[model samples]
Target: MIDLLLQYGLFLAKTLTVVVAIALLMMAAVRARRGMGGSDDGDRLEILDLNERYKSLEQALKESCLSKKAYRAYVKAERKRRKARDKAQTEERQRLFVIDFNGDLRATEVAALRVLVTTILLDRRDGDQVLVRIENAGGTVHEHGLAASQLARLRAKGIHLTVAVDKVAASGGYLMACVADRIVAAPFAVIGSIGVLAELPNFHRLLERHGVDFELHTAGEYKRTLTLFGENTDAAREKLKGQLEDTHGLFKDFIREYRPALDLERVATGEYWHGSQAVALGLIDAIQTSDDLLLTASETTDLLQLKYSAHKKPIERLLASLQSAVAGRLAAWVGR
Candidate 1:
């Protein structure tokens, strides 16, 4: 099972690399157009009416079955019904503010998440709910920590904050998830990995054989506990392991602080679990997808999706183009 997970992890890494390459290409095009004084502005607070989608589907079905005159009459009645429904929602003074976080290992979405959260904080009153649809497999410590703090801001405002995981939210992702007032995961979604991991390759032996000298100076004793080229002493390696264990302790404490009901000792072993299993282990609140939650919430409240977009750097764009080109060639070769 561990081997399978490792293999799957590799596949996921490659898939995400491809996704990143494509996103970078699109961003580069946007950047070029903007450089030419194109009036293409970036992201804003988007309010999506989930009902509009369902309504369109309903109208399509009605149109296929009803005569032209009957369809026209049906459409007029439907408009009236929708107006009444919208009025009721306004009267109730309830709303659903949706945000999305597709996190990379670096947790790059944190910046956008912070912007969106602050916007919601400014105007969101009581009876207003926030929903975050998160897709992440965790990453660096401080990065995900900052991301989790962004979510924490919503709860700090005395507003209800719910998070839905449709695919995976392990490790640093779960670090952020545990901050939610409620967590909902799809049945097949990967949900838990209540542990910490750190790994690297050492090349000191190769360097020594090649008559290369590498010197790393640290002002503090534990400043550089592990290295890529310099020899790693037993004491240094132990210090690194100790640091990981300390991080694991902090992670467990964070989870317990937010969700004290979970049996942390039983499940915080760095083992990933499916949605149903996670629910049983008390790692999540419910077993349901984001789509279902949005559909159900939209029936009575106005569902608005919030997003934040920014510009990318030129060098980053160039690197992405190169990666995409290489990936494209490999794909073509595989096809042949």
Candidate 2:
């Protein structure tokens, strides 16, 4: 009896802790929404000079590995070489603007991507190139389309656009990648998955079992074809399936427009391939990681990493930290 009471008490405490955490999160969100105001320095275009950063890294490594005399000699020679190169190149050096897109299910990064694209369109110089490093498996259709359109904007203006994928770039991710003049990927990076998918749970039978009625009204015939509560008919199912096929048709056409050489019949099967296979399949031009590409380009070109950062309130920061902590704990627990 005592052990049972102890177990129940522990369960109650756990429940109360969860409830309090959720309540606090809700309150914080409400306050943050109400108090949010204008943007500041925290929200702006942040550019990192990859060339200087790489030079610093190289200098640090040499300083650690070489004797003081040897390091000084190396620095002197490097400065002389740089000075000579700069003197010879009296004209403006070409620039390579590097952009990164880490996409999610909603393609929220499009907000920043559009801004970066607009900025580049305004400030781009002759012979300037854009290298977008993308790490995304896939996402929603319309959102990814918007993201892809931003990349296309560069190509539209006759600016060379290169996309590098160190990881996965399947489906909607590949959609954006296809817009690039050249696509590079790490050997094992996942590529392709040109497909459309939509799914939802139906609780009609469950509600019926509980004697619950769900009434749904719509003006159009196909407007409410699929629902979570209302009974789904064969006609409704057929209509939904037809809509999916129509969407898939549009997806294939879009890819064909960008990559005309790709065999749509073979690749548009809703399947994915790694980098090497992708090359043979014409999904990617080369098998190379973004880091290697950037490092090599830094030698001859001014590499600038561009990103738009949004300002976040203190409450938002706190909430993000809390979410990250919880996610880490949950991941650890699951791993165990």
Give the winner by lDDT: 2
lDDT of 2 at 43: 74
Task: List per-prediction Cα lDDT, in the order shown.
Answer: 0.84, 0.88
> What's the residue-level lDDT of 259 in candidate 1?
95
- Over 286-331, each residue of candidate 2 has an lDDT whose tens digit, in order, gives 9999999998988789999998977778996677566545534532
RMSD of every candidate to native, in Å, equals 14.6, 9.1
Q: Output the lDDT of residue 144, model 1.
A: 92
RMSD of 2: 9.1
Best by TM-score: 2
Q: Could you tell me every candidate's TM-score relative to the true structure?
A: 0.79, 0.83
Model 1: runs farther than 4 Å from truth? Answer: 1-43, 83-92, 317-336
Model 2 CA lDDT for position 57: 96
Clashes of 2: 0
